[model samples]
Target: MNSKDFTAGLAELRGLRDEIKTLRKQLAKLETARDKQITALAAYEKAKAERIAPAAGVSVADVVALAPTLAPPAPPQPQEEPAPTPQAATNAAGRPEPTGVPAPDLRRAPGKPAATGTAPDTTITGGSDAPPAVGTPSSHPGPGRQPTTTPAADGEQPEQVRELPSIPPGQDGDTWFTATPNLTSTRPNFTQQPRQMAFLDATTGVLVHRDTTTRLNLGTGSVADILIAVYATVPATVERIYITAGDPWHRDAERYPFLRDAVAAWLNGPLPDGWKIESTRGRDRLAGHLVHPRNPVGRWQRGDQHTEIRSVGEWFDPDGATPATVRDAFVLLWRALHRHWPDVTLMGSPSQTGRDLWSRTIPTKAGAKWADGYPVMSEEIRGLLHATAGQGRTELITPPKVPDRLPQLIELDRTFAYAKHTWASGVGIPRRITAAAFAALSEKDQINALFAPSHWHIRVTIPHDWNHVGLLPAPAAGDRTWHYPAEPGRTFTTWAGGAEVNLALRNPHTPWKVEILDGLLWEAGSPLREWSTRLKDAWASLRAIAATHGDPKQRTAAHLASRAVRAILLYGIGAFAQRPRITTGTVPTGAEHDIPTGAQIIGTDGHTITWQRDTGFARDPYAHPEWAAGVWSAARAALLSTKMREDNLFVGALHLPPGSVVAFRTDAIYTTTDPAWPYHGHPGDYLKKGHLPGPVTGPRTEDELLSLQTLGRAHLAEEQEHHR
Candidate 1:
């Protein structure tokens, strides 16, 4: 071989080796891209199967059918133009610029088919109108079109979805907003209650508006607001969201009504234009949140100090509370429980504790609890109930009973030190029997006879022209939440929108010249009378449970029983018994107040009433609702109304000195020092039940006593500062 040929061949061989090395480098880059595509695909599949696809399901029962193919429309044909460069696809921050929901990535890998769910390829691809490989980006339409992976169901139109634009500078809320990890990246799904959060979707950096027939109004606020608190902004894309997160803040419902109410409000998504928003109630905005999302469940410190849940090892540490205790609590709040806004599953349900205890129905006395024999309403009257709704138009809530100054309460620094003395357990249940107990019995004999069911019950009315002038002194003008006025026989809060009538307030010595406007009797007239049998049955069940169970279990049973009692008393019976009035006929004693019932009693109240002259099924007020069965349901007319009676009559009677009560809970009083309370809470002091004693109970240990005192002191100081 010639020397020149050898030199040339050697040079060519070296060049070929370099080329081989370069090819290896290219191969490494392609492999890396393939791995990324695989990861992204897995993540997307996980999100879809668990979050997106299931979310797209029509009902909780259809989670499996929604995989791979779902409600979104088929992918549009790929754009003919060359793919955009990396710089063109993203903004200054390097995050992809928004185009449309799940836009296609047109940049393709040189050899491999584009994997499902890979991030958009940013390299340029030559202009090609033809479809790319079956799984590649060239097959999908331009970025402006909606998702293309799934086609819409037959005859169904895929609704266009849009994100909430960032609040404009003019409407921008608190820029310094903070978020707690309550609900993270979750929203409700179809067929599941947005409120129950049963079925959920990821909180798209914005919520997607589904073009579905179901008209659900997702109220204002998003679970992503938690991100705003964490990152000061939502993640740039849905891929960053994970809906399976458990509650980062384990606060329960009743203790955290703000969160509970907020969850309820936010489930409907943002409020539409003209939704009635009481700006003061809580509408003041903080970024995307309506109010300060404070945590209600505080962390327990080294000891038992309750404070914010920021303590170390708080959520992970096992709470020492027994499972039975937790179960009981769950039963009580089963109505408000939620770990799902997206991360979803069934958590709990009511057990047999209640059903078994109250299994036996207590038969009503007098042969017929009401001699009227539970008359059924006609279809016409029932239609009126369906149209007008068996509900009242009036409702009001009692204001806080606290005094502006808590100087005395703060000074005492006693935590539940004073025993709370309420009326006898039977006070709300007690009443003298009537001749209706047995129609054949004489009225005089009925009043003195043993307690029994009755067809006739007293209904008192207050005239339109009445005020607390000479007799009962009303609470301060500014305070409308309270209206007990220390009058006996007034077991419930007086009507906030009308003249209060306590027939017991009538001067027995100077009785009014009453008129029997309706000589006719009402069926089981008084709610108190109507509910007596049910109420007694519940109490009996509670007693039976206590007798059956041992400690802790017995205690929990009693508590559950008490909850039922409260539910019946405040909600069930309270609804039906509202607004019973009697004509405040001429008071010969010349007393200046005429407490009456009906339309006249509501004259010149704070609210303005518009009288509707319409008639027939749509306008009738006397209609009975279908839900109102014998003793199973309360009248719908009263269901929507919420009236807060002072659980302690002492509040209205002015028993405690001004500013002496720190906090008033269910049946306990928190004060800095004792206020000469009726029950000194000595050992063995038990609950007061008139002459008979109740279960002996109080702070079990000195530590408990001290803890209460400390909590009361801190709360008093905090409340005082807030008031200031």
Candidate 2:
């Protein structure tokens, strides 16, 4: 507050004031320059815009009219045209008028300023430089607004440039477009046409055009005609068409048209002979449209019931008529379309396998040219064999010839018989016969020999009762029972029973002929002979056995007795008893006139053997004790003949079959004198009684004999079975 402080403060204040004045002056000058530069820049931009707008096919009026709507709206006026308010602007139509129009009030009222211009402090939409002038309504007045006109002054419209339709979300660019490099409004653009097929006759070489909906008519004239007809008739697009022709079965390559050359090559590849072909057809429909005149734009819709036939039958049946024809038409169609659109789906019957049958034969005359040598199979022919024959071995057609001989002839006969048997069995003989079947037969002999043909016929009839006793006559009048012949230079010794004989022989050149030996040798080592001889030998053997240990006279008696017993057993007599012996004592005796004229004693005492149901000797031992004593004495003498106990006994002639034993007893006798004679009598007693005996034991009663024979055979069979 002191005067000195006041004065100092005043001086400082005056200095500050002078500095403020100078700074203020500099700031004012800078502001004026900036304002001028901004005004000049705005003018330059406006001029540049006017110049560029028309060059770009836009006018200044259009540019200005389309300028950024950066300016704000003015105050609203009364609904009524304020009767030419003195200060308001007016048009030539006399609406309103104004002398000074406020310069667009560049200072924005508030908030954000116009985006069209840039101040050093503001962010411009197009950075500091303006964007190229776009069309806009002009500030000056314009007229004649048309509804479809662009926003240009004077309504001079700019041509409309439309954007191409957007591609369907994603697809190949050219899928919907045709390759038209020279396209123009005046020229008609073209697109690819659909592919079509033309079927051709395999036989007559006629082409058939089959469109989407038409069947290939047999009457089709030419490939071109068919194509035109199909194009005119089908309800589908037509792009490509062609004809095919050929006989697929035949090997001639010149038969098919140009398009089918490749197909023919594939089908006619090498194949063996003796193969037959078969093709099965399908009834499935195609998977494309079929629009005929009656059914325009009809689609070949897929359905469960697929039934349609478009291709000709010749494609499968080349002859179109016969069942014997072989063909591969499917392959033809496949090759024709494979190069183009293989994905074009085909609908038809389920697939089936095809077969080819081919056979080749050389005549017998042709075979004769080879001199009966094995004909070698050609490798070329083998290469063409059916595909299934990969595993078969190549072989000659004919067999080599064998040398002539009896044994070889027998073998040839046997072979012929076998072949004939096979033929009778109904099995098909192969086309080519192999040589091995009758390798032993000479080819020349086969070709020229008088080898007679014979057929086998076997007739068998079994009796209703197996136990029935009956005679089986010999097959022929002179044919006797079979006898096994002993091998030459062999010796045999029979068992005491005389049923079997043991033999020893050496075989050098051949196998033992068992079949012949079995029947030939009744006993081992016995010589083979006629049945009569066999009977005689048998009788002699029995006599020798009887006399082995008996009195001289009684030995003879025993031999006779044995012979009688054997005859009885062979004749199958069941019963008999003692009969008188007549030593020619009753011939024409004084009592002989007492007998009936036709009746006479067939047997008698002494010289004649006799048998009776009851034991009564003409010379009774009681009436004549001496005679009885003599009889007993004679019997004792006869009973003494035997070396072995079994020899004296009634042992079976042969061993029993397996699992059995022969039974006999020396005490047993075949004589009528024996107490059991009536029940168990031999043939001797029946002869003495003047009656002929039946078969030995009658059917099953004599089965023991068969068992005996089988027993002997069984032992022999054991060795043979082991060898087998």
Candidate 3:
């Protein structure tokens, strides 16, 4: 609109046009420099590829071929020479051309038959017949490529073929291409070989090689032979081969000297690639280590059935072989192995050997001789001997000499008899006496003397029925019909109201009664004779004391004297009778009708008496001389004999006819009268009998008799009152 605005606008447009012209020239220069840089980069890459390809064991063409961009495109041929079949593309050799790159074939599944004689198609994006890569994202199907609908064959399981990524040339200053040949076609073919086998002899600990044609006994073969034989025999396909060493292999080392070395060599030597060799000792070896082998490769069948081989060694015969033998064999094997290869891996535990193999392998040093002898005498024997002798060590033992004197002989005989009896009875005899006996008698004498009887027998009479006898004397004429004959030679019989009475006799007469006559004769020569004389003197003394006291009743004096006599006799006879005696001996008839040398006269007081030719008695009559004298003195003062006679006379008087004289004798009197005869007619008759003088109590034991005597002397008045 204005002249000045139009002129300014035109000046600005002219300046702008000049600036645009200069920018166009600059852009053209930049484009020309960019082109030059691209052309120079291509030429530099080609020169680098050529320089390094030789060192990489590859040609420059190969390097260029690896990179598609750098490779020259092939010129199109007249669609005439139809695309070469995989078979037709072979080089001068019959083998097909190697595919420089691995390519997936989608038309045929993996692991399937590659159309007979045709190589696997590896052209991924080249010819019209090339199939599309699997899993490649695409919308339209290419020409001549129909969608595959038929399911793959049963054996046509496909495997994904991964193509290794291409490396750029000069990367890491190296250009290398790894050719992945199809393993299915390139793997070397192998024909299977027959299995070569060998067995270990269980009995001999030797290896026996076997084949279809012949069997060879390789007893104690060299280590090398064993290794080669085993290695060559087993199949190449076998990853692990096991050799079993039997028990004998471990046990008899002398027989199997090379077994250990052989096994070691076999294990340590080189094997085929991907191959291994393993071995087993035997069941014993496994059991010792507590290892159980699984999937045994070798086994014998019962008939024709396939069975696993559990053990390679001997067939174990439990009945014929000992476990100890087998175990010993294992120990030997272990020791051998441990000595050679200390770190060898064993199948079974070595702990079962129960010994430190390594420690045992060390040689032992020689030591001083400790002992050498058959039936060697040990410290225990010495100690035992020392213990036996009370003081000194016993260097030697000898049998004691037989006793000579009659007294000594009798004592030895008695002691031996007592020991034997005690042993037989299982009752413990005083050790002091037994030891003395053993010391006195020789071993032979001891054995012979044991058969002799040493027990005592005392004939004692008590009321047949205990209830009939009370603390009182029976009436003289209460019932005459109850009376029975009591003569020594007569057999007592009785009747009640014309019915024969079956009276129970406490002391039945036997043929042994005749022995009493012999006892009486023996008593004359024994200390009992002296005891009887002393008793009579004590009685006389009691009587004299009673007379001086002005006791008119001679019965009381006689009773007291009789009591003293009885007391003396009881105590002395008891002491005499308790002596050990030999009861077994021949009873000489005529000239030697006297008591047998060691025959015993057993008393009723549980004592025994044996005649000693020298001493009159086996044991001393007065073992307690002072006590005997005191007893005599006390009897004299108390008039014990008189009291005893008086009580006896009183009892006799009560039993005899009313005016008849009843004598009290100091001599021992054997009676056959039954004290229970009168009371037996009626059960309650004993209770009706009134209290009588002197309690009618019978001592059941020797101790009871002593107690009664003591009580009678101490409390005569109380006893008398109770009796009354």
Candidate 4:
């Protein structure tokens, strides 16, 4: 087959190879386009599934049935022309500048069917004729108008714009100032904000208004000057005016009188018709009220009003100086009397005129007579003079006897005695005297008295050899705290005229001491004149009793009896009564242990009796029931048979007030064994051991007890009277 045939076939085979390569390249291009279409269809199916899955609850049959009537997708429309750009504006520097216009939104193209659920652009722009953005917030939007816009010109880019929420008028807007009104019924609306300034007026109530801008400097002005300026503002409204005064203002009014005169002048002066100035006398700044003359009948009544001319500064200083003129006079008189009584030896050497003269003696034919200066004493002295005149070498040196002046002397003596007692007790004037003084003085006067000076004579005594005694540190100036050491045997003396002693005694720490010394000291010019009189009378009566009671034994016996009765009544009864309790065993619970009637149970002392149902009588009168009734009867008879008489002994004339409970030790036989008992070996032998003494026998009920007490007191008073 030859070389020529082989070469021609090889050329033809090369041409066929080139044609096959071209066909293969075209098939590869078609496959690539087909792959692209397949990917697009897959994405579309996925999206469709996602949208339908939310409504999967719908039956598939219903979906298929509706599918036949469903419209096919709309064909894609043509794209619209791009927004036209405006001509560029030239700036002062000759550079092309933006027209401040906004470009159209490319997010929603013109021809592409709008996607469902896509948000509409509500952005605003600068063009007046542009349609309003689809969802622009507007109270009233015009139809067919696009949002105004200013598009960028050729070769220019638009500036970035920020969307802001629109705020309607009347709602809060973005601004620096906000207004809020507090006044509901009334309002004072000013074009511009007003500056607040207080206005002072006398007669008007609080009034607010805004008109004038006159501002006065009141910082350095006098009250009167400020008031005048305020009044000069004439018809101006006022909120309030403050009035105040200090100590000096009242002092000036009191001392100078001209200050008050000036005030009266101001009140009567010509002022605004409606202006009425109310002034407080002192530091009280409360608004003053003027009640109508006929308030109950009047239609309108005046209310509290602020003062215009108010003084606020302090004026006077307090005067703490104490006066001692009366005390000095007393001391002088006392010294003079001491000198006058140079011959008087007894009764402590008469260092003071107020010392008692009872101990003073005058030599007489009858031996000696007391210089008490009683009216009856004068007659005795005359008789003594008559008897001694005839006796040779008989020189009767009689002490001066002025019966008429005895009352004053006695009063002085009593006062000094009280003062001495007060000093000794380490307490100032007693509470009784203080109460009497308080009852007589007004509240204001009492306050004044607290600050007022009164005479005081305090003597502080320490141990003789102990030299540690010294004045306590002075209290801080104006501090009223006071301390007085109440150590035993210490005497305090405060002789100057001041309330310091009283203040110290009145403190809570000193109440007991005050009570102990009550009615001992008298304040100068105090209203307790009755105390002095009563004390003087009592002293005179006592002295007279001493003079008349010649039998010392009888007097001694009576005194002893009186003291015994007082001891039994006060100490035995008021301090020793004990409640009965079962002894030696727990209280019996069963009825088998019958407590016998009249069974004695021992008490501390005294015959007061009490019964315990389980423990028997606490203080039985007798060991045997039969003897109990007889003993009790006898005691009652003995008490009842006794009559109230001058000779009967009792406690002092002072009787215990009614309803006072007298606690006493009940006399009973102690069954408990005691080592000290005389019948210690015989535990039941109460009589041999000697039972406690019984209480006073007569009184039964509280009333009867009180009656007996009254009788005893009367007897005491009678004895005192008889002696006097």
Candidate 5:
């Protein structure tokens, strides 16, 4: 308890204090180490979850193939087997590199583990056998190996050699490409990852392909050349290319023949070796020629304004300079004919229009009759003929006695100016024709109308100003589309193709339906040439009738009546009556030779035609209810052929041999429980039979329409189901 004890105790207290200080220091160091471990664990978990999982999913094959191109890690050779210092390493390209091992500062340690698993692999280093360090290229190749190539030091690709992702056939998706902005990143000196873009291909979906510099360059020249080059370069295994048909430059099917031809040639002929080509046309390219003509000529007016009209034989004669030589001459003559003598009769078959007479000296009937010599008519005669033969002339001209038979000399005058505006007159033969008639014809009688030529060109718009007048063989009871052979002592039945009639019906307010019917009838004959003479006579007679009944309402009624008369005519032409008498032997002079029993002709005025019939004759065999059922059955069969889609009757015509006529025979009054049925009775029935069913005569309630409603719903549901 003395000084010695005190000193010893003080020394013990000092030693205890030193020991406490040392213990505190050790505890602090341990806590720092624990915090670092926690951080490193957190970072490892994040890297595993986000980056590693996604990259791993890329097929091992794809990853390995791309491996050699990846950046290599810095050297980590051990110094005397010293512990590995986990410092952030730099890639060979001097960019900040991934550490492979999660750093203590970045990751937090977990409190506990559900279970301990295998330790992580950390064998990565600069040596060739090391595991691929983060950002470093793998030493060993993986599956689906791609050719290895060195990347540019600047991280910028040469624009051409950069391998783009292979676009999988039939599959559309975003594509990645090296972008310019990332090419030269100075701070990180890192290559920009591929930029995502929508690549467009005709074969591709709505997603578009990015336009790379190479693609742009390929498109720089003539479209045809570019297409050809592209086709040559592409592997032949590719069946077709994805292009833009809607591209503004190549939209018109008519104008870009070269481009289209190039595409076809590429598909069929110019493909690369080790590959075969197929076009979008699929397997039947030849059958598609009709749909896509190689070099389609446009409407008549589209060609040289004046085509040197020359005979097919004369233009091609060995000694002849030919049509091409006389192109300008023919052009001048055409301008002369079209501008000055627009009404001069045209020559050649129907469909050629006026092209046949371009360079030829065609003699008008009057000109030929009045010719002084073999030249037909001289320039002096032409002068005397007046400067413009097409316009109205009131000089005294004798009307030739109503011809016993019409001569086939013809000319078509096109002056249809009133085809658009509403008409002032109530006369409704289609408002446009009414307007044209009023404007072209004088109050007294003369009216301007279409004249048929022996030959003429058919064009999209040419039909607008012309009428086709040629003989078609009359149709028989069984024959609906084609004209039948005329035979004596047999009754004829007339029918029309549903398509033609429907086409005529396109105009909502057309009034010339009846007239069209009549015209159709007069032309019915075997071999177009057979009906030419008779057709002329009929046309002249009709014209006379039209002039006679010029009153609008009367004309309208006459037009309707005329349709029936034409139908009867068609029947006669199809039967053994008038058609046989004219076509079989010689053309008939008048009605006396081959009179029809069912109907009697009363008048021949163009505006109104009269016919007398018993009105109670039994229905034609083709018009019987059984016939209707057969037609419906046929339609159903055809629907089956189209996979249940209702197709046009013309499409079915392929089943028929060439020259076989086709028609869709259906009741004009197509009323049924189904509301979709257009009419309640036949169009011809009311006129011919004088009555119709009464269900259509009365007002009906909405609830009473259950039958039609159910049918329509069923039909629609079927359609939807089929689509699905």
Candidate 6:
């Protein structure tokens, strides 16, 4: 067999082995859980019975009837593994307690006052005939038991009952369980962290730290304790130490004495052969021996398994990211990172969304306070390190379960990734942008474009002259400046035709202008034409997926995200067409702009066009218009307004009063005689207020126009200001 086949077979075998191990452990957990339930229920039956020990002839129906009283409402849990709740857990007396964990419960974290609850349960054994003696310990201690320090049960498999610290109750019993964010993570298994996590792998003894916010490896050890743990053993994978910046030896030395000392030792210690992280001048500082950006200094090496220390902090700038955006951005980034690196460790954070969403409720008795739940790393996370911990499994990964209520956002992320991959370079991750994703791409692109200029940054003018029309429903008087409404006989993009097929909305005072020069830029095979079609197709697929199973809210988010695509495809190219390839603005203030080809703009007077051609003759800059102002603007004008207005790209066309027009906004026509389209009642992108007008697709009399002239004049001023 070939080497490739052998490698593939070997990988499959190893994966199967891990899968078998995971399955066996999970089965063992199920058995333990089932045993705990059986134990609790049996004890409960005996306790509730007043007469002789009630274990005789108890049927299944009676036990089933009692379950609903303590069981938490089951929602659509992703993994189908229902998490054990306090009500379902086997307490010290080994019975399910409704109030909370008892004082003797060992699981409560140190210093936390044990909750006041019912007496510890007695273990029921020998066919539930009688309870165990008072001091006897139950087989299963349930959820709140002191966390087992042993990594695996009997040292055979990983821990089954992971330490998932639940909400510490208030005087009112922590009534805020529903307020939990129900967050989605980029990590598979939908793992979420209640707080940032750091760990020393149970088996490997290798210390690891991960930043959940961005899913990147934060520096392993900066805290003195963490440093001691990292070097406690010269780990197989440890080669270089990466610091956030040069010489962490200044103020940091005092803050992290242990780390500083380690650095000093490594510096003064004899260097290993093939050691790296060189420096000449700053030997006094680790910066001289070590780093910048991510200072990587070799700790040790075993051919091919180089152990290096990585300082991974400076990259995550949380300045602009807020709690809200960070949450949304997490959903977006997680999807991208997960598909790229599935099977990576999942992290958890105490949910921030709960307190914020229910913040105003705090003043009332039922309010949620800011106390975070005790967070424990998810089993998915623990499993990650367990499988490869001491084996130096430092690479990242994620699992496949999606968060509840976040399917739509996840889909948007998937679509965005597909779109990003369309760029010349396939890497679509935004390394620079942080702190939460904005609902609008315009905001994100504007903020993150600093990494490099994108097509979104290009700007050019689309010149045009004002053209008049003969009023509503009547075709404009100029050279085809406006398109009359047509049939909704549109396909793919043109839904219900007419204004719906293109950009033209039924605005009362919105006049149609005709292009004076150049061919249609959005005609078949052209960039704009291809782009709009592609966007329409992409959006159509997304819309179908959303409508079939998604809710209105998802559809709304999908539409908002689509604007970024439109900006890239439609507007991005529009910016390109404004200037031909060879374009030069006037070097001097008064000089004219110059274009080498395609619809060149030429004018002698400075005031009329303000730019002129400076080719050959060294004319005064102030005396000439830009030398290359040519046909590009005219083409741009055609694409931007003239042809585009008639292109039929409406977002749910409104029914306008055919004969007598009123006013209009992007989609809604305002004819109520009070505030019109330009006058907004709210400060958002979309707002609708008008009732449907009569189905009249003809012209009104000049007398009707006369009465509306004043309103028209007022609207015209607002429209200009709004656009400006």
Candidate 1 lDDT for residue 524:
24
- Per-residue lDDT tens digits of candidate 6, residues 384-437? 212211110011001111111111100000112112111111011111111111
lDDT of 1 by residue, 498-604 (tens): 00111121221111111110011112222223223344444445545545667766456455544444343333322222222222111212322432223232111
Please provide, for model 2 over 241-301, each residue's C-alpha lDDT reduced to its tens digit, 9 standing for 90 to 100.
Answer: 3223332223333443432332222222222232111122222222322211111111111
Residue 379 lDDT (model 5) = 22
**lDDT minimum window of 10 residues, candidate 3:** 514-523
RMSD after CA superposition, every candidate:
36.6, 66.2, 63.1, 56.2, 43.5, 35.0
* lDDT (Cα, tens digit) per residue for candidate 4, span 118-174: 011210101121122222221211111111222211112223211111111111211
Model 6 whole-model lDDT (C-alpha atoms) = 0.25
- Tens-digit lDDT string for candidate 5 (588-662): 235444444555543232322223343332212111111111122222222111110121111121122222211
Which candidate wins on TM-score?
1
Task: Please count the clashing residue pairs in each candidate, in the order shown.
Answer: 30, 52, 25, 37, 46, 77
Which stretch of 10 consecutive residues in model 4 shows the poorest summed lDDT? 406-415
Mind giving the per-residue lDDT tens digits that candidate 3 earns over 143-173?
2111121111222211211111112223221
Better-scoring candidate (TM-score), 2 or 6: 6
| Candidate 5 segments exceeding 4 Å error | 1-295, 298-323, 338-472, 476-481, 495-724
Runs off by more than 4 Å, candidate 4: 1-228, 231-257, 277-307, 314-724
Worst 10 residues of 2 by lDDT: 352-361
Stretches > 4 Å off in candidate 2: 1-233, 237-315, 321-724
Cα lDDT of candidate 2 equals 0.22
lDDT for model 5, please. 0.22
Give per-model TM-scores.
0.26, 0.12, 0.14, 0.15, 0.15, 0.19
Report the error of model 3 at residue 526, Å. 5.8
